[model samples]
Target: MRFVRYGAVGQEQPAVLDADGELRDLSGVVPDLAGGVLADLPRINPQSLPRVPGNPRIGPPVGRVGKLVCIGLNYSDHAAELGVDPPDDPVVFLKATSAIGGPNDPVIMPRGAQKVDWEVELGIVIGQRAKYVTEAQAPRQVAGYTIVNDVSERALQLERSGQWTKGKSCDSFAPMGPWLVTPDEVGDVHALDLSVDVNDARMQSGNTDRMVFTVPAIVSYLSELMTLHPGDVIATGTPPGVGMGHRPPRFLKEGDEMVLKISGLGEQRVTVRAEG
Candidate 1:
């Protein structure tokens, strides 16, 4: 089932996408799609519901997010485009959980920053607690998957950064959701198509098939290093075609727009604005 949290930023209500792709208000029964609701998704009656009028705001399904993790250069082609060797293991980083925001909100740029870039990523949400789990047992630990922008300020990330978080953890940087698709519903997460578009111009286009590290491997590796708790989100990293991958190094400026999507997980379109 495609589960969603709709309404405004602080007031999003639980919602589920019906079989026909219409949004069904789940607010009547489930208050929100976090914690216990995520573990019991199978029992949801998506059909016996009312259609949501207009386009309700799509917030990240899991409210009150815990730790927000990210894997860098997980795509071989993305590594190639950047002219860097793909790391032997997943390159891990942490984005501020506070950076999380609604799926369609504007990406507010940081103060004194100009080199904003977009990365389309397949995000994994943990359902149960896991630590030191094997790859074979990893998929079973994941609750579901979602799309993430993994927005970055390239200059801050590479040139003047102590850590990538300086550019990665800005407010509104991580625009996620539209839906959190359960693992069973997504089939093989490895073969899906995904892309990112800036102001109607496509910037990143690729597939999960190109990922250097598969979902199970990423989860297993992460679990070994830290405990995976419920409501934790792991952004599986981006594909080739980031603005930084360009020869002239194209970067984002104010008033830009980004429409990013992944197959099966749905779409995320965001406007870009400078910080106040």
Candidate 2:
């Protein structure tokens, strides 16, 4: 099933996509797709729920996210573009939950920012607690998958002295979801294609099949280091062709528009704006 959260920010209502691809209100059944509730989303008849009227703002599918963990350089080609060798293990980082925003929300370029960039990634939403889980057990712990636009500030991320968090956790940096698609609906997660387009031209294009660390490997590895709770998200990492990897090193500017998509999960259309 493809689950979604729609309405205004902080006032979103739970919903599920029907066979006809219409949004059906699930608020009557579940409060929100967050915390422990994700572990046991009821399998009910979609037709029974009231149909949502017209179009509404679509918020990130998972709410009250405890942790927005991100894996850096999960793609070998991505690592190469950054002039770094692919790591033997996952390069973990964190994006503040405050960075979470709706799919179509505008990306606010932080004040004094000079290197805003885009990264299209696949995100995993944890459905249950996981600790020391093996690769085989990883699948069961995932609630679903979503698209994540891991926006970044390269100057703060690489040119500064601190960790990547400072550059990665800016407000409106992590735009997620149009849907949180259940595992059964995704068929093969590793084969999905991902892309990012700036304006109307394609800037990034890659596939999950090229990931240095697979979903199961990433989930299992992270579980060994920390407990994975429901509603916690893990952005597996982006593919090559980010603005930073361009010949002249392109970066986001105010009024720029970005369109990101991952196979099956859905798409995101966001505009860039300068912080007031």
Pick the lDDT winner: 2
lDDT of 2 by residue, 143-255 (tens): 99999999999999999998999999999999999999999999999999999999999999999998999999999999999999999999999999999999999999999
Give all TM-scores, in the order shown: 0.96, 0.98
Query: What's model 1's overall lDDT?
Result: 0.88
Q: Itemize residue pairs with steric clashes in candidate 2.
A: none
Give the per-residue lDDT digits (tens) of candidate 1, residues 62-117.
87788899999999999999889999988999999888988888899988888999
lDDT of 2 at 256: 93
Model 1 alpha-carbon drift over 4 Å, by segment: none
Error of 2 at 180 (Å): 0.4
Task: Write out the backbone clash pairs for model 1.
Answer: none
